[model samples]
Target: MAAAIMNLVRVSDPDTIVLGGGVAGSANFVERIRSYLNPKTMRFVSSARS
Candidate 1:
């Protein structure tokens, strides 16, 4: 999954990424994602405040 995303980022060079919907419901899903993608880009999303 991370490898696929990394490939996309490398090809696209986007400025920002957004993670929304059900996957964002997981507690550490965003963090795990950020850890894999940084310090390459920034993410914009809401956290699970529960």
Candidate 2:
């Protein structure tokens, strides 16, 4: 899931990413995704939890 999100980020270069649905309700899950993201790549991207 994190890999997929990263891929989308690479393609879309969005400033923000909003997560929803069942899995997103898990704070751990959200954190895990955030963990996988590269700081360099996400320099301009907003938090997924924002």
Candidate 3:
């Protein structure tokens, strides 16, 4: 999903990405993986939640 969370944010360059079980609690699915990421890899990467 969302290209495997952007390949684990390009190999764990993580500021904050905390998703939980059950398809990350459905709904919008974390804004559809923050609109499919890659706005320059989301510019230092703020929070993402489940």
Predicted structure with the largest TM-score when compared to the true one:
2
Which segments of model 2 are wrong by more than 4 Å?
Answer: 46-50
C-alpha RMSD by candidate, in order: 5.6, 1.9, 9.2
- Tens digits of per-residue lDDT for model 2 on 13-39? 877677889988898988888898888
Pairs clashing within candidate 1 = none
| Model 3 per-residue lDDT tens digits across residues 1-50 | 77787888789877766778987888787677778887785666665554
Any idea what lDDT model 1 has? 0.58
Which 10 residues in a row give candidate 2 its minimum summed lDDT?
41-50
* Of candidates 3 and 2, the better by TM-score: 2
Model 3 alpha-carbon miss at residue 17, Å? 2.0
TM-score of each: 0.52, 0.70, 0.28
Count of clashing pairs, candidate 2: 0
Q: Write down the TM-score for model 2.
A: 0.70
Give the runs in model 1 whose Cα sits over 4 Å from its true position.
38-50
Give the per-residue lDDT digits (tens) of candidate 1, residues 1-50: 55666677678876655556898767688667656754534242232233
Assess each prediction's global lDDT (C-alpha) against the native.
0.58, 0.77, 0.73
